[model samples]
Target: MPELALKKETGLKKETRSEELLQLVVFQLGEEEFGLDIMQVQEIIRIPEITRIPHSPDYVKGVINLRGKIITVINLDTRFGMEQKVHDDNSRIIVAEVDENVVGMVVDSVSEVLRLPLSTVEPVPEIISTKINANYLKGVGKLEDRMLILLDITKVIMEDAPSKVAYC
Candidate 1:
């Protein structure tokens, strides 16, 4: 419910425009396409300096004081077990609120927000013969050779990772 509330706060194009389908904020994580429920995103900020917290989880990049509110930041790349990349010009922070907790995830350049019909949203593929974790994906959105990995943001952040991340 909070996620839905967050989406409402985003002031994304009205659902009526998409015929009641949820709007998806698409972005790039490495070479893959990822989508987030537009409502969950609070803001898109250019990547900022993240102070690493000693003894914290490897995926936890650090914390940021956003308008006086301390928010934990996560490196989605590390969380997803991908190679960590230095934040650059094309990098961004997608601030999303989940269950009242707002966290920022580092990502490659953001693409665009598109309307994804719920009917077109299918379950994630069962083959981890693939490159990503199925639990993090809600489904795939097909678009003329490009497939957007529809993300279940809460699941991606809240669920136990498929494997433990080795701390550097």
Candidate 2:
């Protein structure tokens, strides 16, 4: 049951579209895996140098020059009230489109793109002990050995935005 051996056993490749599910891009923050709609993801890039903007919230990591366009980067862990982590070489920025605007999210690592069928996706249940609000989550999805929290990206961002940002 060593970590490496367990990974090897679970790493067997499968056909991309197995007629049951659509692919999702998976990434990690702390110990949990979360997913966003694959079609919403523009690209994954290395941690870029961000220009800090004064008067912004701690979760707003600042802007990055992506091919000459400035995009805001948000730290998911911080937004969720988790302790901030120091960035390392393995850290990544996942660019996703919401409300026609491209935003980058920082994650500890990108795991894989998985194809999950509609049947495997379930409504987010009303769990009394859940720490985060349900508006930020679309649903819970079950895949082979994992359960992913599918994010409603637009809602997540909108819920935290200032009145000015929300209308823009």
Q: Which structure among the candidates has the greatest lDDT?
A: 2
Judge candidate 2 against the unseen true structure and give its global Cα lDDT, from 0 to 1: 0.80
**Cα lDDT for residue 159, model 1?**
71
The superposed Cα distance between candidate 2 and the true structure at residue 42, in angstroms, equals 0.6
Q: What is the C-alpha RMSD of each candidate to the true structure, in Å?
A: 10.1, 8.9
Give one digit per residue, the lDDT tens place, for model 2 in 24-137.
899888888898889999999999788877777777888888999888888888877777778788789999887887888999999899877878889888863565578888
Score candidate 1 by lDDT: 0.78
Error of 2 at 155 (Å): 1.0
Q: Which ten residues in a row have the lowest lDDT in candidate 1?
A: 159-168
Model 1, C-alpha of 133: deviation from truth (Å): 2.8
Model 1, position 33: C-alpha lDDT score: 88
